[model samples]
Target: MSDAATKSDAAMKPGWTPRSAWAGILSEGSFGAKGPAGVTATAREDLGIASLIAPEDGEAALSQVVKTRFGLDLPTTPRTVVLAGRALVWAGPGQWLLVTENRTGFASDLQALSGLAAIADQSDGRAVLTLSGGKIRTALAKGCMIDLHPSAFPVGSAALTSIAHIGVHLWRADNGPNGAVFEFMVARSMAGSFWSWFSASAAEFGYSVHVGRG
Candidate 1:
């Protein structure tokens, strides 16, 4: 082994070690044996509609509005939920998702409510980047601005925030036994730039870039 490799191995003998193991795993080139190790990009244009009010009033409004607008009954319990629509995914507890679709005209329907709640048309303000691989979260921790531990953010949960200094919405994908994967919705204008930075941060972790279908 080269001097550097020897030293690297020696250092890892104890609890102290470099991130080379993680690096190698990400650099591997096997198909489904291990999916490519890299950051993949996808977009979810989320039209976030949230109803904030006193507990009693909000509860009644949520029940009535959800049934009237989407013909679905709201959950009685207080918890975060997601309602999947043909073009949109409605996240409960006063949250909804017009996922990966535009909501240019959806605002009109919301405006008709007249102070019943607050509606935010965030279609033009967000995009998504889906990062998948066994080492995905480990790679992300190198620069992510939020705590991504499963204990903190379980599956089917999401956080509206930023990574690598760019605004984004992050959620864990439920694509059946795929290990750990994350889908990030970032701003369209920042997509290209964030990709460059995200890829570089992932280099030491062995990233193989690809076009992902969500």
Candidate 2:
């Protein structure tokens, strides 16, 4: 181990191991997995409180809103949903999805808009994390209380579930290679505890932890 690795290991709490490989990736983005070329990974984070509630028109409404507010024309069949600078995917019914970016500027847009929708700022209520690697599914199985096998969950699908007793927004990534990357969104208060639980479960798989911007 390098000097820094040695020191990190020494300072780590019991049952915890420091991961160095992902240090750089975390610092670059909010949540998403870094992987070898052609491999897939899922990443997730909170979309600060810039909530947009559109009506049954679905993508049409979303496109119109994007054009009118941001002058951006959204794609019709976007596998990833982007709103207020945050990207999200559907987690369950009721037109709900998980946002994976910090909602820094979303509040103002929602406030000045009027349409067939509702908007709420939920920036303070959530936290996010990214999971990736060839063994991601195996790693997640350690704590997730769901049948997350590809046949069941499938790519491009998302679900609201629990991990270590905390509610999470779980989404499968579309570009995942070998089906191994995923993103998770959780409540802010549960961040530390969930990390602890996730790290513990990942130990046997040679898991490592990286703390930084991503």
TM-score of each: 0.55, 0.58
What is every candidate's alpha-carbon RMSD to the true fold?
Answer: 17.6, 12.3
Clash total of candidate 1: 9
Give lDDT for model 2: 0.55
lDDT for each candidate structure? 0.53, 0.55
Q: What is the Cα-based TM-score of model 1? A: 0.55
The per-residue C-alpha lDDT of model 1 at residue 144 equals: 80
Candidate 1 segments exceeding 4 Å error: 1-39, 43-59, 71-80, 86-115, 175-177, 208-214
- Which candidate has the highest lDDT of all? 2
Instruction: Tell me which residue pairs clash in candidate 2.
Output: 26-214, 40-176, 40-177, 41-181, 42-181, 42-182, 42-183, 48-103, 49-122, 49-123
User: Candidate 2, 13: how far from true, in Å?
Assistant: 35
* Candidate 2, superposed: residue stretches over 4 Å from native: 1-86, 98-105, 108-115, 176-179, 211-214
Q: Across residues 104-193, which tens digit of lDDT does each residue of candidate 2 receive?
A: 555655655446355555565555565666667777887897777878866656677888888887766654435445667666667667
After TM-score superposition, the amount by which residue 119's alpha carbon in candidate 2 deviates from its true location, in angstroms, is 1.9
Q: Give the count of colliding residue pairs in each prediction.
A: 9, 10
